[model samples]
Target: MAIATPQQDTPPSELAIEARGLVKRFDATLAVDGVDLTVRRGSITGILGPNGAGKTTTLRMLLGIIDPDEGTRRVLGHENPRDVARLIGYLPEERGLYPAMKAVEAIAFMGALRGLPLAEGRKRGRALLEDHGLGEAADRQIRHLSKGMAQIVQLLGTLVHDPQLVILDEPFSGLDAINQGKLEVLIRGLADRGVTVIFSTHVIAHAERLCESIAIIAGGRVPFAGRVDEARDRIPAQVRLETSAHDGPWRAALPDTARQVGQFWFFPLPETGVEPLLRALIDGEAGIQSLSIERAGLHDAFVAIAGEAAAARLVTSDAGEEG
Candidate 1:
């Protein structure tokens, strides 16, 4: 199989995927409300939201698997997704593989379905298996492989065509830490090769680490869409202090943003250094146990944008699934 080539003829537009006021309805329930998203060519972007937050629906619409009731979309520079279907690769959240099929055979079959000849597909599949550290398992049946192996095989099948754009839905749902890390590396490799990647994940950490930009959807609507740094900037820095003196004159030195959290007092650090506060606390004879400043992360940004309840729900759900 020929290596999937980077898009040689660049689209006049810089975007790989763009949607305007995309809306999808399931019966009377609006799965995706009016949402706008744009993924730049060769950039890795993430669609982040909790379960049932319309991420899957939005992806489907963008891929033309499902049409939106309202709005418009263009994929890979084509007005219609089918026009460039061969240029796109998709890995759905639901995992499936032919249990009786050999790993190499399975991957090759997928490539063949996407227009690659069986012989070439098989050749490429073998090489890919070796590259992915599954060379010994190439001839083994899918049913004999571990869940992680099967998952990687399925994902590789999605990549067989060497698509210009890869859209993955909850790609990290069931993988353990090691396999998850491997997948992250694979995603970055794709981006390094100039492939546009749009992945939807409930896990924000994956997006934080892998994406250049993100579209944050909540309640079926996108509340934020921009670079990761922009999102992080939406929330202020945090300061955590553990002090033996919980009250008195030391309290006066504390910023108005300060709040007690068990034995620690948490607050948003002002733009100025904490030196003044430290001096004030010491002058007031306050016994400081520990003090640390933390830069705001995606999780903190998400909470600030989507509210604590929604963020907490996603964290709880992710923990349960991982456990």
Candidate 2:
């Protein structure tokens, strides 16, 4: 299927999705707090948050699956989402495919519902399957395919219509590293063709690797939104050092906040260069085994801005899932 691209004279609003002060309530609980988000055209943006941080709720409101209690949203420049629903493709977190249907049939069926002709959908579906290394499974029933294969088929179904904007909710929730890598490549291909991609993922590394911009949602609100580098800048750089001398004048020169992890010392990089510290160690005859300066990653920034508690919870959940 051909991807859609912006026209030379396309309107000045080069945005795929925009929402301001969005809020949602479910009975007695507030599911989504006031949140503002912007997704640029022809770029991949990530919505990152913990399990119940309202990522799905925010997407639902933007997709017209549900209305926000307070705030406004525009998708593809349409104030009303339904007006542009057909121009967007969405893959929900939940897997929903008929077990009895052949893989190609299921993909084409979904496309047909979105106004894609069955014949054309089938042709594209076969091509998509072949391109994704699933050509042999095209005739197999959903029940007989591996979980990863089924997932790929569903994603192909989402793309069968060649939507201008694609929304994926927790697209990597359950997949091995190889399949996850494949999905990332697929997402990049879509953006390269001028298609906008907005995906929600709790895995910080995924956003750090794939997103040009991201919205960091926590506790049902977005606390940060901007370039990926901006998020990483929220925290200072870090340093790790190892030495033969455990205690000496060199040790005294180290910051009081320095922490020891096994045989290594870890701490935030000092405002000054390592020259002074190195000189101190040399003067005191402290043998430097190793040293490394590291920049803050998305996880570090998330912890600094969203608080250790939330970061800990997210990390724990991620570990459990991966295990």
Candidate 3:
């Protein structure tokens, strides 16, 4: 189906979701603590963290799937998110589909739960399937489809109701590279149509590529939240230098933080700038074979903000559904 593009009547700066000091606990364990997040209307925002970082818990609290032990949230102007649940679409990390149901029926059923009439839902579902290259699979049973195809069906269901705000938890978890790329495109398309998209993922690359703003969570606490550029700015740019002389007085010009890896020297650009270092290298007769200043990327920023230990868990399997 050609998703209807909502009129862009809302200001870009208008808040779609505002969550303050959200806290959730299970037994004696704190899953989410003191998370404050904001999403601008018509923007793609990401909740980024490693496995077991409470990303899912925070999202659930925001959606009113589970009440926060403390704090408050406003979703699409409703102080209680449940009051506006019909306008929000959520795809949980744990995906499910009825084995006996046809792909189209599954999508329609999901839409019906969100208030779309079954007949209308089925019509939209078929159109969506055809639009997404799943037309041939529309009549196939969920049990017969490949894992990737089934996941696509669930994703299509998430949008069948054309929700104004969409929340996805680790939407990329099990997909291969090809499907992951396709999903990314779909997400961008939603934002283009003026839908507010908020997704949680441990993958920094996805956030770096798709999210205008991000919240970095770790150990049940949010360490950073804002525009991607602002998060990257938390760390200084890095300098990668390769000199003809591997060792010389020129090395003295390099900061104490500099480390030699292979033939390259890596360090944060000194506060005084690279001019002084370049001059010292030239005067000291250290042949400057190559020099490059690299801006800190999302991965670097994540490591800096969440600590190396937390960053190490990014690519690991999620600890539980709440991760």
> Which parts of model 3 are misplaced by more than 4 Å?
1-13, 247-249, 316-323
Clashing pairs in 3: 1-127, 1-128
| lDDT, candidate 2, 158-188, per-residue tens | 9999999999999887777778889999999
* lDDT, candidate 3, 1-323, per-residue tens: 01111222334348898777888999999898888887888899999998789999999999999999888788998889989888999999999999999999999999999999999999999999998899999999999998889999999999999999999999988887777878999999999999999999997788889999898899988878788999898899999999888777887888888998999999999889989878999988889999999999888888988899999877633222222
Q: Which stretches of candidate 2 lie over 4 Å from their true place?
A: 1-12, 275-285, 315-323
Clashing pairs in 1: 1-120
Q: Worst ten-residue run, lDDT, model 1?
A: 1-10
> How high is each candidate's TM-score?
0.88, 0.89, 0.90
Residue pairs that clash (backbone atoms under 3 angstroms), model 2: none
- CA error at residue 303 for candidate 2, angstroms: 1.7
Model 3 per-residue lDDT at 104: 98
lDDT digits (tens) for residues 1-323 of candidate 1: 01111222335488898777887888999888888887789999999888889999999989888889998888877879988888888899988889999999999998887788888888999999999999999999999999989999999999987889999999888888778889999999999999999999888778888999998888888888888888898978788989898677888888887889899988888677789879888988779999998889998899998888678756433344452
- Among all candidates shown, the one with the greatest lDDT: 3
* Candidate 1 segments whose C-alpha is farther than 4 A from its true place: 1-12, 242-250, 271-290, 316-320
Single out the weakest 10-residue window by summed lDDT for candidate 3: 1-10
